[model samples]
Target: MSGETTNETWEEIVVRVLKANEVSLVTYVPDNVLSRLIRLIEADPFFTVVAPAREEEAVAIVTGAYMAGKRGIALMQTSGFATIVNALASLACPFQIPLLLMISERGTLGEFQQGQAIVCRTMRPVLQSLGIEHFAIQERAHVEFVVDGMVRQAFATQAPAALILSPLLTKRAA
Candidate 1:
C-alpha cells in the first residue's frame, strides 16, 4: 500500500485499540508523532492521561496503575526509551507489570536528526538486551494486529510489550 493510504491517523487507530483492550490509564512523555493520540485520550473521560515528569516516572506510574487493576499504556520517543531502561529492567521486569508502550521509532529512513538515527538503529538491540517483547508497526495495516496481539501478550505474560511506531507507519499532519 502507498504510505498515504496505509498510514491512518494515530488517534483513530489508537482509540479503537485501547478501547478494545479496555485500557483506562495512559502515561506518557510528550511525543510529536503521538500528540493527536494524546489529545484524544485527554478528551475522553473514561480514560486518564498522565504526563509524567520523566520517562522512568511514566514507567513507575504505569506500574502502579496496573497494580491498582487499571490497564495502562505509556507513550514516548525512542530516546525516552533509553532513559527508562533501568526502570524496565529493575521494576517492570521482575514485578511482571504488563505495559503497552507506544514508542516513536527514530533514526530510521527519512529521519533528519543524527542523534535520532543512531538511537533508532540501536533501539531494537537495546530492547532485546533487556529482554522486552516488542513489535514494529511499519504500516497502517499492521496496527490492529500488532497492537492487539502485543497488548494481550503483555498482560498474559505479565511483562512489558512494545509497539514501535516508525515514520513509515505514520504521516505528518498536513
Candidate 2:
C-alpha cells in the first residue's frame, strides 16, 4: 500500500468507505475532485445520489433524508462549504442529525483561486465555531480511517461531522 504503484484511486476508496458505513443517501454540489466518487455512488444500487442546485440545498435534502431514517452524506467543494454555513448552523446543528460531509479542501498551498482560498482557509475554523467535529484526509491510506471515524462520531452524537480531503489526496490523475 505504500509503494507508488499501489495507490488506490480516491473514487475507489470513497465507494468502499461509504458502503462500509451503510450510507444510503448522498447529496452533493458538483465538484471535479469528487466527480468520480459521485459517479460511483450513482452506479451503485445501494446508494441514492442526489445532485442539488446549491450546497445549502444539498444540506437540506440530506437533513430530510436523515429524518426519514436513512444514513446520509453530503459532498461539496470548499466554496460550497462557505455557502452552507447558515444551514449547518440552523438546521443541521440544532437537530443533532448525523451527517457525513466530504469536503474538497481548497484555498490552501497550491490553490490559485483567490475566493476559494479565502473560504478554504476559514472552513475548519467555521466548522469549529459551529461546534461541528471534523477531520482532514490528505492521503489515500487515511481515507478509511477519517471517513469511518467521522461517521461514527456523527452517528453516536447524533450530530453533523465532516471529513475534509486535501487536494494532495484527491489530485486528478495525470
Candidate 3:
C-alpha cells in the first residue's frame, strides 16, 4: 500500500484543515468515525477538548466559547444530530453564534440501524430549517477547500455551519 493512490484518510485531513482555521475549543458526544479526529485534536495544545454527555451540550459549549472569542466546533454522528436541534435553534441561531459541525454520516451508505437511517434522512432539512448552511464531504480533495471555506464563512457571518462527512469519506465500521 506504500505507493498507493488512495484518498487521504478523512480524519487526518479534517484535523489539519481545522488547525489551519484556528479552531481552539472542540466538543463531541463521541462516535466511532470521529474518534480518530478527536484524539488528534486532543493532543494539540492549541485545542481544548470536551466530551459532553450529550450532543446538545457540545452545541452549547461551542456557543459559549464563540462568545468568549474562541474558535470552536462540534463533532458527532448523524444520530447525535437529532439531539442538537433544539440547542441549535434556541441558542446558536437566534444568537448568531458561529459553529462548525463535523458529522459522520451514518444511516446512509449501508447503515444497519433504523434510528440512524431516520436521523440521516432528516439531518439536512433540519439544518436548513434552522438557517444553517451545510456542505457534504465525500472526497479527500474537498476537505481542505470546503472545510476552510465553510469555517471562514461561518465565523465571518457569525452563523452555524455543518460539514457532512459521508460514509465513503470515513470508510468506517458499520
Candidate 4:
C-alpha cells in the first residue's frame, strides 16, 4: 500500500493526522466548512472539542490547554483567523506555544461572500507579519504529507503553524 487515501475525504484525512499526532483538544468558532471535521472530532473520545462564541476565545482556550500540557488545534475560517490576530501575536507567538491552526480559506477565487474575500486577501500577510508559518492544503493529494509534516514541525519548534484549506480542495465545504 502506498499509504495514500482515495475514498477518504480531506476532513477525514485531517482527523486522522490530528489523532495520529495525539492532538487532544480542538477549539473553534462555528464554521460551516469545518463542520464535517468538527463532527468527526466530536465523536472521538480521544478528542475534546470546544466551541467558543468568538475566535479569540478559541485561541485562549487552546492556549490554556497548551499550558496544561495538552496538544490542541484551532479550526476556523479566514475571517475567524483574522479575529485572533492579537491573541496569536500577544499570546501564542510570544509564549512559543505549538498551536496547530486549521483555517478554511475564504475571500479567494470563487468565494461568494464579500467579507470572506476581503479577509482572504489579507490572510497571508497577516500570518507573515506575525511570523507564523502557514501553508495551504489546496489539494487532497497533499493532505497527508503537508498536514502531517506541518503538524510535526509545529510541535518540534513549539511555534504556531497553520494549514489553510483552500476552497479548491474542498468544494463541498466551500
* Candidate 3 lDDT over residue span 1-174, tens digit each: 122324556576777777878897899988888887888888889889999899998988888888888899999999899888988888888898888898988998788889888879999899888879998888776677788889999988988899999887778442
Residue-wise lDDT of candidate 4 within 1-174, one digit each (tens)?
148688888888888888888888999876788888888888889999888899888888988988899999988998888888889889999999988888998788788889888878888998999999999877888999998899899989999999999888877453
Clash pairs (backbone) in predicted model 3: none
Clashing pairs in 4: 107-116, 107-117
Best by lDDT: 4
Summarize candidate 1's per-residue lDDT along 46-88 as a digit string, tens digits.
Answer: 7988897898988889899899999999899998887888888
Please report, as a residue range, the 10-residue window in candidate 1 with the lowest summed lDDT: 1-10
What is the TM-score of each predicted model, taking all chains together? 0.90, 0.91, 0.91, 0.94
Model 2 clashing residue pairs (backbone):
107-117
TM-score, candidate number 2: 0.91
Residue 39 CA displacement from its true place in model 4, Å: 1.3
User: How does each model score on lDDT?
Assistant: 0.83, 0.83, 0.84, 0.87
Residue 126 error for model 3, in Å? 0.6
Q: What clash count goes with each model?
A: 2, 1, 0, 2
Model 1 TM: 0.90
- List candidate 2 segments past 4 Å from native: 1-7, 172-174
Give candidate 1's whole-model lDDT. 0.83
Better model by lDDT, 2 or 4? Answer: 4
Residue 141 of model 1 has an lDDT of 68
Give the per-residue lDDT of model 2 (tens digit) for 91-135: 899888887888988788788889887878789889999999888
